[model samples]
Target: MAVNIQKGLAAAGLAPLHVWNRTASKAEPVQAEGAIVEPSLESLASKCSLIFAMTFDDAALESAFSAISALSNKSKETENKILVTCSTVAPSLVQQLEHKTKSVSVLSAPVFGRPDAAAAKMLVAVLAGGSETEKNLVAKYLEYTTRKITRLGGPAHTANVLKLTGNFCILSVIEMLAQAQTLAEKNGVPREAVVDVVSALMPGPIVTGYSERIARDEFDVGFTVDGGLKDVGLMRDLASSSSVSLPFADIAHGHLERQKAENKDLDWASLAKIVRKDSHL
Candidate 1:
């Protein structure tokens, strides 16, 4: 995802892109696209006016932010630096970041897309928090990497909550596809036939894509069940706080639990396996 973001920015004529990953080897690939791999987060923070973090989860984001925050304290250069997080995190954490990082602008840009969509620059971004100027600066470079950007305005946590809810919706669709395919196969019909029928009716990416993914057993890579669980947990928390109920999320949560036990290595779309198992297929 980082490499593709850098590649898109470079293609847009954004120059001297700087990238740093906890694992230096993981960042080496971006260098091929003309980005300089920095030795430390501090070094990267020092060089760039805006720093974008695409962390895996809360802990990863915290670690990355701490490094940048520390650098901001010691150097005058990063005082006005904008910290844009593209991670899906709890809304509370986003608020905390806004509170703690007085010197830096914290903008939440939680994205929606699988790795394939990311590589294709088809990701949808939701931007929240920071001044209008700050957001425009962040969006300028981000526009190169995303299909569309939605600005939610102020209280960066709004973007994080929305990101969690978006993940819940995607997970719910995956669960629906899983159950639908299971029923089709149990009736002695092929899952591909079900996929074709759905494609003709609705013809959207999440449905068509997962239907194909489930039918072909191409669940070896991409978003993991563990990753899905983290996002689901966040969404559930959001639902609870807002006094709203998400029954599909509850259902998906149960399937994900089974997924963790049996199909942990497969891509999260393999939540379909649980439906198949329930039918004793």
Candidate 2:
């Protein structure tokens, strides 16, 4: 994701790109696109005016923040830095980071897209936090990487909450597609028949893509069952806190758990296997 973001930036004729990754080798690809791969965190912090982090989870995001905070704001660049995080973490974590990063402005700029979308610069970005000038700076660059940028214009954590909510809706569609395809197969109907109906009705890339994945039995790539379980847990916890009922998520959780127990590394679309078993297919 970081590599592609830089590619978009470079392609759009943006200024000299600076990047730092935990793994030195992983940052090399972007160097071909005119990005300077910094060796240490301090070098990155000192050089970049707007730093965008693409950490995987809360622990990783917090660890990166801690390392930067330990830097003691030595550089003048650090004193006037904008930290825009694109991690899919809890809103509370974003809120905490805002309070903790006394000098730097933190923006919750989570995005909705798979790796393919990111590579193609078609990501949907949701941004919040910072003053109008700060957000505009981040969003201005984000325009190169994302198809649309929705500035929520509130507490920095608002974007994180909305990101999780959007993720839940996406997972719901995958879970539903898995069930629908399995049902069609069990009823002596060709899976393609159901796929055809879904394509004609929904017409969105996600709906059509997953429907075809199910029909083609292509469940070996992309998001795994373990990943689905993690998102499911996040959504369930969010729903519980809000006194909302997500019965479908409860059902998908059970299916994902069963798949995880089998120790099979399958894509999320393979959750249909559990549904197939229940129907005795």
Candidate 3:
């Protein structure tokens, strides 16, 4: 993730690409690759006209913005500065960030891709914010980072909403794969064989890519088990708040929780392995 941000910054030709990480040493690799390391988030936020953040969740985002808020008044008072947040957070929380940094324009710009996709600059970005001038500034900056940009709605966390909804679709596929592969393995069919059949039928990136991992129990933490659980929890909360019932989401959330209970170190794909082992497959 740090590498992707560095690559994007280099590609965008941004000067003094300052970065701050939770751990000091973690930013070393990016620093070695020509990114300037900021000692604190406040320093980073104060110097830039545009600040782009990609943290883990709402709490982290809020913490970063809180630091930014502490320094907001020290900078120029105009709305010339912009914050392009690329984290997958709750819409309501994003609204809070915007309200806190009232002088800074906030743009919700969440990305979709694995680490490799991000490094290759092939990630799809979803942008949602008002201020056409701000959007253009952001788009110009991101042209070197992503293959495409999708603009949704203004003054709303539309990008985060879309990103979460997109994850639900992936979660559905994961649940189906877990159940179907478990059935196949129990029936004495080779997991690889089952994967091949599904791959041929689906012929899409998600199916083809995850099928091999499920066959080989390759649930490494590019996306971790804990993270999947977090998303499922958030999705369920969103559904409940909107008065919608999501049964499949309920099942997926259960699988994630089960994996977390034991072998909590496994990746998101560990949910499939849980079903496989449970079914004696």
Best by TM-score: 1
C-alpha RMSD values across all candidates: 1.7, 1.8, 2.1
List clashing residue pairs in candidate 3. none
Per-residue error for 194 in candidate 1, Å, reads 1.1
lDDT of 1 by residue, 1-281 (tens): 77777777767777668998888888787888788999889889888878899887888888888888888899876687888999889898888888796887889998888777878878899999998988888888777668999999668889998888788878888898889888989899999999999889979898898889999888988889988888788888888988998899999998988889986768888888888888898
Candidate 1 regions exceeding 4 Å error are: 11-13
Q: Residue 137 CA error for candidate 1 (Å)? A: 1.0
If ranked by lDDT, best first, what sequence of candidates would result? 1, 2, 3
Each candidate structure's TM-score, on Cα atoms with residue i matched to residue i, is: 0.94, 0.93, 0.91
Candidate no. 3 TM-score: 0.91
Give the TM-score (vs. native) of candidate 1.
Answer: 0.94
lDDT of 3 by residue, 80-181 (tens): 567778887888788776766567677888888876776677878888885887788777766655888888756747788788898888888888887888
lDDT of 2 by residue, 143-187 (tens): 776899888968898998898888877777878987788788878
Where in model 2 is the C-alpha error above 4 Å?
72-77
The best candidate in terms of lDDT:
1
Superposition error at 150 for model 2 (Å)? 2.0
